[model samples]
Structure formats: structure tokens, C-alpha cells
Target: MTDSRIAAESWETLRARHSAKWRRYPADVIPMHVAEMDYPVAAPIRAALGELVASSDMGYLGPMPEIAPAFTAFAESRWGWTPDTSNARLAPDVGVATVEFLRAHNVSRVIVTSPVYAGFWHWLEELGIDIVDVPLTSDFRLDISGIEREFANGVGHLLLCNPHNPLGRVFGRDELLALAEAADRHNAVVIADEIHAPLTYPGSDFVPYLSLGPAAERTGVLVTSTSKSWNLAGLKAAFILGHGDRGTELLKPLPEAMHWRSSILGAFSMSVAYRDGVEWLDSTLDTLAVARDHLASELKRLLPSAHLEMVPEAGYLAWVDVSGLNLGDRPWDRILEEARVSVVPGTELGPQYTQHIRINFATSPELITRALTQIAAL
Candidate 1:
């Protein structure tokens, strides 16, 4: 049996680190805010980084032909869908890749489903693109009809979050196919940010947008990385995957510096992670599953009024409706002040979600218990 506690890093060790998750709040505050996992780095990635540093091989990023094959292999093995590797391109991170993909396609306006990743709003704002929000259904599934309406109304692009953040809803193949068909009908483009696909829990199927066949290949562009899955965001490397003639044409306008700006260490480490990090990933998933269950049970026992609605099917983020707690319009502020437990305010994800809060359960069951206990006491 896999040791479910294997991924839990000691609080003492984690607290001493300089990452933003630890540093943003004071010593007294327990931060469950950031998306970063509290698990130790994967062995393959660590070894690769150590080897690179030991040889003093750090230099400008160059042709890393290994990235494409590694990603394709992982995709094939994990999802049974092999992407075309010839059109793969590198970028500093997912944000940069997304921004550049939008810019290259001359997309002036885009549709986003909320409550979505907070970064999506920041990215579009930076590009001066108009945002058309088609919020998900109350059940946290895609508003396919709403999305189709936006595309029909002349919104030519969409920024999608697969294995959605906060909600942790891994969209199904039927939903994605419906979306792909809608985009094809409207001559629209879909840029799928599949960063969380690898973290999807068992029983929830994560459908890759580009894997939906001809319509998807024509209308979809994929951007993903080892950063989210392997907890390597600070290392700064991600890739853009294009497919078919339309996909290939859309990527042609991306600047050459997009690849050059990527860190060599990040790129090489990402390759190593894709090629050799499966065992560690599987172990971490087991640990995460244990943590996720702990959060659900603790919340139900300690804070019954806090409605978890649906347990997350992927990743460690849990969206809770704290309206029942009567924490007011700004519940997160009250929680921060009283409980000293920091979590993401739902308003940051979408304005209508003021009564909600996003909790990161990527830490140990003990930390989850500690944080929930603090919040429940309020």
C-alpha cells in the first residue's frame, strides 16, 4: 500500500523556506492561500537540477528538442492521446505562453468562465483584451450554452481552465466536444490551459481540448507545464502546443524570444520531470487524496454550516460557501483577522463569489485539521 502520508513535509522545514506561501504572511498566520503544494520536490527533477548546477551548465535556453517528445509520451501514456510534437514551442511560463498566444492570434476579446483562476483576469487586462465572462452552472459544470452564445455574438477566442482551479471540476469529453463544435461553428479559437490535468484525481476524467478530433484540432491550442503538477512554478518553464494547419498557423506569429526567455534549468528539469517523475507524482496523488478526504470530513464536522457542495475531484483546492458562517460580504477578511488562517477570497476569482473562499489542502492532514479548527472556532 502507498503511504498516504508520504507527501507531507514537516511544518518546521516548510516554515523555514522563503517561498511566497510562507513569506507573504507573518509567522502567526497559517497560509492556505497560494496554489503551491507543500510536498517535497520530485527526485528526478531535483537530481537534474543538481546535475546542471554542479556542472555550471546554466546558459541561455536553446533548442530543447527533448521537451516535445517527453510531453507527447506522457500524454499518450496518461491520457491515451498523443499530441503532434512538431509544433511544440517553449515559453517562460503558462502566463507568458497564454499572453503570447493571444497576441499572436490578434485576439481582441475573449470569453472566460468564472469563478476561474485569478490569473486569467490579470493576463487579459495586461493585453487590453475585452473579457466576456460566462460563469459556470451552479453545479460547477461548464455553461456550454452560455459559452456558445458568446462565440455567436462575435467573441472569437476563449481562455479555458481545464481541471478547473478552485472548483476542481474536471470537464468531461462531451462538454469539451460541445465546446469545440461551438467554436468551430463560430470560427473561434480556444486556448486551453491544462496545467492541472496531471493532478486530476482518480475517477475524474480530464479531457484534453485538442484531443477531441478535427474540430478541436482546428480550433484549439494547448498550453501546459510541469510547474503545476510537479510544483516547479518558481523554476519558470512551460510550453505551447499547436495542431493541424490552423493550429500551426496561429503559432507562427509568436516571437522567437518566447523560447529564449525560458530558463535552461527550468526547461531541462521539465523534460526530466515528464520523462522520469511518474512514480513521485503517483505517490503525491495518493497523499493528496488522503489530504482531500481529511479536509472534507473536518469541514463537515467542525464547520457544518460551511457548504463544500462537491468535493474537489482534482488538485488540492477546495471551494467552500462560507455564507452560512455569516462572515459578511468579506468573509475572508474576518477569517484572516480572527482565525489567522489565510485563504483566497472568492471575490478574487469572481465578483459574485464573495461568500465563498478557496482553501489549499495540499499540506498534511494535521495542517488541514489545524486550519479548519482555527476557522471553526470563529
Candidate 2:
């Protein structure tokens, strides 16, 4: 039997967690919202963080020469793709990297595929950039023709979510290559958010935008972090990878403080995660796969009217359509009030998905069962 790396504590014990998922709701609420996992930090990452704290090594963050190489090894081993280290830079997180890269290129109007990671809206709004919404196809893949129309008309940037959040759709190489070609033809930059790439399941192919083709290498900027995969969001470390003159120039305006903003503990822990945490990661994946199927079965058995739009291709979040539940305007709000289960509101992704709710299933099967049962009973 494979050892499971992810296991959830009881509700009483989990209530003590200092994270937002636990603290945001009252004691009666079961949090199934936040992307962070309920699993304990990996032994390697915990050990790295512990050594830093013990030796009093905490100080202003400096260039860690190890991050690029460690990430290179992890990427190659896991994805069979090797990144160019010279083209990589560290930022506090993926949000910061996206904002700075757009600012560097003086991007005023950007296109986003909806529904998207909610944070993408905040990043664009803060920079005073106009948003052009290109909603995904009904099947939840990119609307390529829509993207081309937006790009040809004046949109200069596109924010892409690969192994997309909520939907968990791992985009294919052909689709990504077509996007890269469209961007290159229109001289538009594609900022690919690939943080969830590492979490993809066994058979799903996660094709990195940068590895798509020459057009992709020229037109895409890849930003990713260890936060999502290793459950280390609080650590605050991410990588910005670019290639050639276009890639390098787009990255040049990142402020010097970008590096300083990352925690020293985060930097080292990230390196350790990439270099030595593979065994733990594999174990975690196995657990998550079983949890994913378990949640689907539970939901199907309990709520026959509810629809899981896509059996997730990756990650623990499940985007469920509750349209059949007969819950009004804010179905998620009703779920929380009646069922006492906290889920991410569908409207956060976009106004069109008001009947949908996102559930974080990265917990013990018992918690998933409890949450689904409560919803079904309501």
C-alpha cells in the first residue's frame, strides 16, 4: 500500500489553524473554499524552514543561486522540460510577477479567459488596465477565435491559466501552440499562469506555453510557484521565466525590491521542495486522486440533481453546478446559510456562473463526506 502524504485533522483540531480558510468562518462552518491544502507541510520543506529558524538565519532575502537549478531539475524530472535558468527571476508571488511584467511592457488593455482565477481581476484593476473578457467555450476550453479577435483589435496582453483553476482543464499542446501563433501574429504578449501544472493527474498532458513552439518561446511569459503544489502559499516565492529579447525586455522593469519581498524562509523551502520533495509529492498525488473520486461518488449518491461540470483533470478543487438545487441568485450563499458549508461563490469567477460553487477537497475523505452530506440534506 502507498503511504498517503495528505491527511486531515478533525474539525476541533483544524479550527485552531491560523490560515484564512479556518479563521474566516464561524466555528459551525466547514471551510471548503481556500486553495491551500489541509495536509501538513512536507518533511523536506518543514526541515528546511526549521533549520533557518533555528540558526537565526532569517534576514533580508538575497539572490539564492540555488532556486533556478533546483526548479530546472524538478521540471525536467516531472515534465521532461528544462527551463533556461538565465531567463528566470524571483518575485514575491505569481500576482506580483504578472503585474510587474505588464507594467514593464506598458500594457494598457489585457484579455482574460473567463471564468478565471479571481486574483487575475485584482492584478489588472490595480494596474489601471482595461479588461477584455473572452469567456471560455461552453466546454471550458479557450475560445481561440475570440482571443484572436480581441488581440487583432488592440488587446496587447492575455492572461492564461493552465491546468486552469476551478475547471481543472489541462490545456493541450496544439491548443497552446495555436494561441502562441495568434499572439505572435498580433504582437501580443501571453502571460501564462502555470502554478497548477505540477498538480496535474497521471494521464493528463500539461503543456507549458513556453515549450509549445518557437512562436510560444517568443510570445509567452511563464510565471509559476511552489506554493500551490507543495501547499506553501504563505512562503511567498514564485518564478518569472522568459526567453529571447522579447521575454528579457518584458522582465527588465521588475523592481529590485521584488526579490527582497520574498521571505528568506520561503526561498530555501522552495528549493528544498523542488529538489527533495518528489517522494512526498507523489504520495500526495495518489491521495488526492482517491479523494477526487471519492468526492464525486459522494456528491452523485447524495445530490442527484447537482452536476459536476468536469471530472477534474488535476488539482483538488471541484467546480460544481448547483443550478438544479433550486437555490436563488446566490446559490453558494444559500449553501453556506443552510448547510453550514463554506464554498467559493461562483460569481467570483464571473457573473455567468452564479449557480456554481467551488469546493476544496484536499482534505480527508471524512470531511468531504460530511460537507457533501450537509449540502445534500439541505
Candidate 3:
């Protein structure tokens, strides 16, 4: 097996790779804003894609029995929960699956926990739904009482981001159970985006929303993928999982196109990933655990004034409080222009978080060091 713990390619080689993370910025800039990792694809996944291409087997997607069982096996092994494979369906990606799920239910408004994934806002607005922001509490956990308040005001859908983006706090099991109770009492539906669940660090616990209990099973739907977990976003495929009979029935009316829209290559790779990508994933997680610590320590050493909102509990992104640096309204701009390090500006996350910047730290320790050093120099 290839060593997933090390980034084999140098900056010059990586810059020429075919991905937005490389092409979006100039060569001199360290592009650490996007979620794509710096590691190579898993050997099992690479071999699967290669064989498909070599045989000219690239065709439209069709039913593959392995999809559901593969995910079920992974979920059971990783999180100790097993989803009913019969409750799963395919979509082009998480975004499409989310919007389509909302549309199918005639949902016109959603309760969103903000300072969340920016794409949640985009997807809701594109569906012509009103978004009610229940921003994360100051500590970056779900504001359950605030969410309950919003639910009381007539919103039927809650768009949840588990193992949240940017801040990277993996929502705890008790919090999720309380949320499930609230949703059940208010008759609200939860559409959880669990795409980042697979990448959660060793000590963090990522509780699947649908696995909470009977109340949660009735009120929840999960949209997840190998895209974020396996760096297959460009390939375009994801799954929508309903908890039980009620939840499954709710998802049954989705347009047939949702299934057809998924890429054949993506579906094949996703199955391969869940089944055979565990070794690679374990190695990547080991590497990221080190990288995560390295980034945090480097930030303290180089930029003591800048505060990390929370050390990420999962994934590679770090949400930092750059307000202490006093670098104008948008600190990311200064960092990009002066430090030549591209990071996501806080404003894009939400109006309440304009003083922050989300940094992707899933790279070599050397690059993490350089990026922090540059920011400090600014």
C-alpha cells in the first residue's frame, strides 16, 4: 500500500495537478482554503477507476448492490451504527440531494445553524426557501434551545452540518438526542449533511443524526458522500439515507433523475472506498492528527494574538479569530495580499463571523508552518 501519511508530490507537481485547489490560485500562493487534501488517492480507489477506464466500462450509472452494504459496514465499524440499506438512494451530490429533498416535501423555509457550511445558504436560496439563521453558540456547538425557538415559529426543516465545517466541532450524541426530541415535538424534519463524518479524528465522536433513536429516526434524513471523505467531490455522487419506515417513505418520491444524475465513475469509486479504502483512511487520519496539532502549535508560536475559535475536533479546516490582529474588516484579504496565503474569508460564512478566517490544514507540516509564519509576518 502507498504511504497515505506523506504528501509524495512537491509544490511544483501539485500545482499542475487537475483540481481547483491547485488551479484556483497563482503558483506563488499557498492555497489552503479548499477542503481537498494534499495526499494521493487510495490504491484501491485508483485501481478501480483505472480498470474501469482501461476496459472502456464508463457508462451510465446502474444499480450496484454493493453501495448500501459498503456504507453500512463502514458506519457500523466506525460509529457503531448500521443504517438500513433499503432506506438509501443516490443523488448527483450532497447539494443536489439536499435541494431535491426539500423540494419533494414542498418545504419553503428551513432553520439553519449558521456560521455553518456556506453552501447551505446557497442551496436553500436556490430552492427559493427562506433561511432562518440560528447561529452556533459562541463556543461553536449547536444552539439547541435557539433551534427549538425557531422550530416553534413554523419552520419544518432543519439543515444540520454534523462534524461541522470550519469550526470542526463534532456534534455530541446527547446534543443530537435533545435535538431529535425537539424536532419530534415540533414536527420538524432534519436533513443532516454528514459528508465530513468519515474524516473525523481519532478522539472525536461523530454521531449520525438518524441513529439517535425512534424520534430521530422519524424526523431525520442524512445526505452524505465519499466526496469529502475520499476527495471525490469532482466525481459527483452521494447518498440520502432515511432512518426508518417513515423517513424512508418521505424520500421515496424523489425524482428518478436524482438517481440517474450520479456519475458512474463516482458510484463505483464510492463503493470501493467504503469497502477497501479503510487502510488508506486510517493512515490519512494518522497524518492529519499530527498536522492538526502542528497547525495549532504553529499558530500560537507565530501569531499569538490571533485566536483559534476552537481546535478542530474533526476534519482539516480551522476557524480562527483574527479580530485580535486588527487587520481591517476582512483579514483574509490582507493575509492573501501580504502573506500570499489563500484562505476563506469569514464574511462568506455568515454576517456574525466577519472577523474570522477558515484555514484548511490538511497538508504537509512544512506548508502548515509556512502559512502560519507568513500570516504572523503580516
lDDT scores of the candidates, listed in order: 0.90, 0.87, 0.88
Which one wins by TM-score: 1 or 2? 1
Deviation from native of the Cα of residue 54 in model 3, angstroms: 0.4
Off by over 4 Å in 1: 1-5
On TM-score, the leading prediction is: 1
lDDT of 1: 0.90
How many times do residue backbones clash in model 3? Answer: 0
lDDT per residue for candidate 2 within 340-369, as digits (tens), equals: 999999888876788889999999898889
lDDT of 1 at 187: 88
1-378, model 3: which lDDT tens digit per residue? 334455536877788887999888888899988889988888899999999999999888999788988988999999999886786889889999999999998999898887878888888889899999999887677899999998899899999999898788899988899999999999899998999989888788889988888989889999999998788888889989886688668898799899898999999999999999988988888888888898889988999998888888888899988998989988898999999999988877777888989999888899999988888888
As a whole number from 0 to 100, the lDDT of residue 147 in candidate 3 is: 94
Error of 3 at 118 (Å): 0.9
Off by over 4 Å in 3: 1-4
Quality of model 3 by C-alpha lDDT: 0.88
- Superposed by TM-score, candidate 1 places the C-alpha of residue 354 at a distance from the truth, in angstroms, of 0.7
Which structure is stronger by lDDT: 1 or 3? 1
Sorting all predicted structures by lDDT, with the top scorer first, yields 1, 3, 2
